[model samples]
Target: MSDDVSLMLRASRGDRKAFRSLVERHQQSVYNFFLRTTGHPEDAEDLTQQLFINLYRSAGRYKPTASFRTFMYRIASNLAVSFARSRHRRDGVSLDQMLDEGREPPRHRLHDDPAAGAEWSELEEAYLAALAELPADWRTAVELRVGRQLSYKEIAQVMGKSVSAVESILFRARERLAEKLEPFKE
Candidate 1:
């Protein structure tokens, strides 16, 4: 059994420490997923908290048929989609809000040179703008595959689609992203 599954089993048996361990292990990755997916720090924080809360509540229902990482991401993906839908209904803002909001989305800085940093920042902004333009399903697939490094099968499981469907979504998403980023390549 995986370490996460073992922790979850212990958690389901009322081990608070086990549950806390699971949370500590997975929280940052989950937060990063939500942060990139939602493009808002506050929403990402809320969703991360909610994801763990739900996980604790549903611990009894967890089975080891899938890896715990996949299960956790499945929960995160559902929450993200629901959050996006409700936000769309309530705010009706263009997805470009991710890029045009005057604040940069959180990212690790890898360069110390001012020129390199500015160029990298610009590229990151452009990429995010292009990503926001993708259809929701395609974006989720791409994010799961590229951002989280899930296998196609794992992504399909998370998205509740067949592997072929996941493949098509990824193919289209990559094509669209390439088109959008082509100008930036020069």
Candidate 2:
């Protein structure tokens, strides 16, 4: 078994140290996943804590049918949906509004140079804006495939969809992004 799998198996037997080890090993990845998907650091921290709490509560039920990451992200995917639904109901902000209005996307540099200038900043903003325009599930799929570097099969596992479904989602997401970013092409 992988070390992560071993840790989880030990955790199932009520090994708190093993569980803490697992949490320490994986927490940053999970936090980055939430931050990328949600674009909110505070929300990301909350969701990361909630994910570990859920994992601890359900450790006894964890089966080693897949990789530890696949299992963790499966749980993460489900939590993201639940959190979005609850936040929407409580705050009354529609997904479209949330994606398009007020909030800035989580910034990723478009150029390596710190002084890449206003042109680079505009391009970066356009890219993030186009990314935010994707449907949440499609966005998540793209993030898994491109941002997290998961294989299509692994993405299928995390997303609870077939591999081909992941392919289609990513294909469509890419097409939409290309269309949205076409104006910036030189």
Candidate 3:
């Protein structure tokens, strides 16, 4: 979004209102990116705040040589990697994190049967647990593609990989996700 770039440029020149505008326009998407990828609302909120601060601090250094969103997400991806590594180092939390309230199951069907709702809850839990277990890079790719609705090329740019690599990663990731969810596919 060129408008984002413009806002960023204005921010670089110490334009506070412009920065606020930029944050207003994209904070939710960025928050969602962190939330789905990290599977913890608290962590996601922290990460989202950190990203904006990081972006603001680096505003002067930004070059609009590429899509601003791509640049922004590349930074976000790095933060995700850092968060994963830190969690791995600090507490062995890499395997046990889970998505919560980041997505919602259909309410109508879920309420129709208490049994079905319980089953659906189990299925959703399994899916989140499986997603949390994926490799950080794979999870990042999945979040960027599915959650952010980024194109393959956009994902490639965000991840600093080739388009083919993005495609391959997403393919493998999807196959893995399908396998994890297969039992719930009735």
Best by TM-score: 1
lDDT of each: 0.78, 0.76, 0.79
Best by lDDT: 3
Off by over 4 Å in 2: 88-120
Winner by TM-score between candidate 2 and candidate 1: 1
Per-residue CA lDDT of candidate 1, range 1-186, in tens? 989999999998889999999999998889878766776667888999999999998889999886898888889889988887777532344334644676444332223345664655555766776676666677777888888999999998988999999999999988988876665565
Q: All predictions: root-mean-square deviation over Cα?
A: 4.9, 5.1, 6.6
Of the two candidates 1 and 3, the one with more favorable TM-score, higher being better, is 1
Mind giving the per-residue lDDT tens digits that candidate 2 earns over 45-85? 89999999989888888898768888888888887766765
Q: Each prediction's TM-score against the native?
A: 0.82, 0.80, 0.80
- Clashes (backbone N, CA, C under 3 Å), per candidate, total 0, 0, 0
Worst 10 residues of 3 by lDDT: 104-113
The list of candidate 3 runs beyond 4 A from truth reads: 89-121
Clashing pairs in 1: none
The residue pairs in collision within model 2 are none
Better by lDDT, candidate 3 or 1: 3
Per-residue CA lDDT of model 3 for 1-186, tens digit only, reads: 588888999999999999999889989999988876776767888999999999999999999777888888999999998898788532233322322333432322213246664655656766765677678889999999888888999998888899999999889988987886775567
Tell me the spans in candidate 1 whose CA falls farther than 4 Å from its real position: 89-119
